[model samples]
Target: MNSDFLKYQAQTTPHPLAMEISYANGSYIYDSNNKAYLDFVAGISATPLGHNHPKVISAIKKQLDKYMHVMVYGEYIQKPAVELTKLLAKNLPSSLEKTYLVNSGTEAIEGALKLAKRATGRSEVISANKAYHGNTMGSMSIMGFEERKQAFRPLLPNVKFISFNNESDLKHITKKTACVILETIQGGAGFIVPSNNYLQKVQKRCNEVGALFILDEIQPGIGRTGKLFGFENYNCIPDILVTGKGLGGGMPIGAFTASSKLMDLLQDNPKLGHITTFGGHPVIAASALATLKEVTESNLMQEALEKEQLFRKLLVHPLITEIRGKGLMLAIITPSSDTANSLILKCQEAGLILFWLLFEPKAVRITPPLTISNDEIIKGCEIIIDLLDEIQQQ
Candidate 1:
């Protein structure tokens, strides 16, 4: 099966983890050999309630019995899509009343960028130095990192990069800028939080310059950070709120939301700014609705803090320099990238699943499911610490 996967499937990496998954439940995944691995990454923080959650599975089953993909996006009055959008509006700030559902985070980013340009009638876009919106052209254009993107040159034009959490760079967001986009928590960049009222200062600058503020909450959305969205923690609201990754539970979904007046721009000007075939698939919407219900209704979000403390207490080691992040989205910083990789490999061998950060090589990502048990947290962290200790002796 491993050989077949390597031969058949298109891989992003040459050496992929070829564990043949048989089944998954809660915070654990079982391989074909019935080996249970405690998951800490949660499919890159997409599974809000963990794998094959009862609510999510049940919602999917119920939706399967009903209709699926009956109409194109925004063309039909799909009940699940409409209801989900309405529910999101009810929870979000009143200005973010309109929602444009898309296939993935990158698509929503493209839509939002186009909408920003159309609404403000400007072309220049600004994003953070380590931002990871998505892999698409527009998102890649605003990504700030040139090493990975230099090969895919000539992306979108008039895009500039500014240092993340640096208030001094707020001046770059000027009247000529169409929009300023940023990850509320800077996911790929070590989950770095804004410091010293950085986001507030950026928001003020954008307002003064008439540039729209787009907060990409793809990784931190869906109550991963003890809030519905990471931007809420900072007190400033974004003109455009982009979400994906965790929004669909285990399914694929993305959306960019804004005021009705701002969102209406996508309808005119070019007469259909952005369009996608499977943006609002009914089954995905059903799963997302179920996930949102669980995250918002239950005490799962608040319990995240307790779970985080448990992880911190157990993940102690001289190799672990610091634990950077809030709620379940944490990164354990090791002495070096080699040490981080060794610890992850050793931990996986010890029946614990761990993963890496995209840019922060020395930081191992530890964003588990928000519904992970205290026992599970302790179990995973113990494995990590034990492995760190073993590797330190080497």
Candidate 2:
């Protein structure tokens, strides 16, 4: 199977962590040989509820019994999609009352960009440096890291970048800007959190310039950052809020939300401005609804903060320079890129899963599931600390 996987599957990287899994439950994924590995990355922050969560699985089963993809998004009123959007609206700020569901975060990003252009009648978009929206052309075009995007040049034009958390950069946003997009908590840029009213000042500037402020909460949303959305912690409410990753609970989904007044613009002026055949498929929506319900209704959000404290308390060593980010959305910065790589690969071999940030080679991602228990947190941190200790000894 491993050989077949490599032979048939087109991979994103030359070497993949080809773990042939049998099954996963709670916080552990078992290999084909039944070797259990503690899950620390939560499927890259997409499985906030952990592996094969009962509530999410049960919701999928129930939805499967009813129906699957009956129609494309926005064409038919599907119950799962409608309920999911309504619940999201109830949890979100009043202005963000309408949602357009898509298949992935990048797709939602594309849709949001389109909405911004349509609503404002402008095409210029301002993004943050080191920002990562997605792999799609529109999302990629706004990406700040030019090295990866250089191959995909001639992307969406009129997109410019500014240094994140730099207040003076607000001058770059003017009336001609259609929208200014930013990751509420910059994910790929080493989990950098907005500092010193940076987000608020950006929003204020956008307001003054008549530009729509869009927050890409793809990695920081769905209660991963101790709030329903990361922007809630930063005191900045975006004109358009984009979310995905952990929102689907394990299924594939993405959505962008705005006020009904702003969202309704897509309906007319050209009818069907953005369309997806399976954006809000019933099964995925059911899983997402169940996940969102569990996240908000339970103590998981608060637990995320408490767990973060536990991680900080335990993960201390000479080789570990600093920990960046808030709540579960965190990155441990090592003294060197080699140390970071050694810790990740070594930990995986020791039955602990770890990952790296997209652009920060010296940073190790620690975005575990919100449902991960105290025991799990302590165990994972201990492993990380032990590895760092070993690295220090060497």
Candidate 3:
């Protein structure tokens, strides 16, 4: 099976953590060998309620029995999509009321960028350095890191980058700018959190210049950061809000929200401006709606903060330099890239699942499922600490 996987599956990386999965439940995944590996990465923060969650699975099953994709998005009055969007609007600020559902985060980013350009009649877009929006042409164009994007050059033009959290760089966002997109908490950049009201200041500058303020909450939103949206924690609201990952529970989905007046622009200027066939597929939307309901109705959001404290309190070691981020969205910064690699690999071998952040070589990702228990938290942290101690001794 391993050989077949390597030969048949096109991989993103040369070496993949090829775990042959038998099944997963709650906070643990069972490999084909029946080895129970404690899940700490949560499929890179996609499975907030954990794998095969009852509610999400039931929603998917129920929707499958009823219907799937009836028609392209916006043409059909699908219940799942309608309910999901309405719930999202109910939770978000009044300005961000209407949502455009899409196939993935990158596609949502593309739509948001197009909308910004349509609304402002401007071409320039600004992003933060070390920021990662997505991998599509437009999103990649605004990706702050040049190394990953340079190969895919000749991307969208007139896109600029500014140093994140650097107040002086706000000068770059001029009246010609269409939108300034940033992650509510920069995920790939070692889970860096905005400080000193930096996001609020950015919004202020974008308002002053008439450019839309867009926040990509793909990694930090959806109850992962002790709030429905990470922007709520920072006392800032964006003109355009993008979300994915945990919003669909373990399913694949993405959405971009803005004012009805702004989103309506996609209709008139050019009829059928943006269209997607399976953007709001019924099964996926059902799963997302269930996930959102569980996250909002349950105490999961508040418990995320408590779980973060437990992780911090337990994961104390000399080799660990710092833990950056808030709530379940966290990265353990090791002293060196080699140490980070060693820690993740060793933890995997020791029946614990840990991963690494993109662009941040020295950072080990620890974004586990929000439903992970306290005992599971202690157990995972012990494995991490034990591995760190072993690495330190070497």
Q: How would you encode candidate 2's per-residue C-alpha lDDT over 94-204 as one tens digit per residue?
A: 999999999999999999999999999999999989999999898999989999999978898899999998998899999999999999999999999999999999999
Q: Give all candidate RMSDs, comma-separated.
A: 0.9, 0.7, 0.7
lDDT of 3 by residue, 136-182 (tens): 88899989899998888899989898988999999999999999999
Per-residue lDDT of model 1, residues 1-394, tens digit only: 9888999999988778788999999999999999999999999999989999998999999999998887778898888888889889989999999998888888999988988989888999999897888999888898867887999988887889899988888878899999999999987888898878788888899999999999999998999888999888887999999999899998999999999999888787687788888898999999999999899899988888777888888888899999999888899998999998998888888989889888889999998889898888887877887788789899
Question: Considering lDDT, which of the candidate structures 1 and 3 is the better prediction for this target?
Answer: 3
Best-to-worst ranking by lDDT = 2, 3, 1
- Segments in model 3 whose C-alpha atoms lie over 4 Å from true places: none
Residue ranges of candidate 1 with Cα displaced over 4 Å = none
lDDT over C-alpha atoms for residue 248 of model 1? 93
- TM-score for each predicted model, relative to the true structure: 0.98, 0.99, 0.99
Task: Report lDDT (CA) for all predictions.
Answer: 0.89, 0.94, 0.93
Total backbone collisions, model 3:
0
Model 2, position 255: C-alpha lDDT score: 97
Clash totals, every prediction? 0, 0, 0
Against the true structure, candidate 3 reaches a TM-score of: 0.99
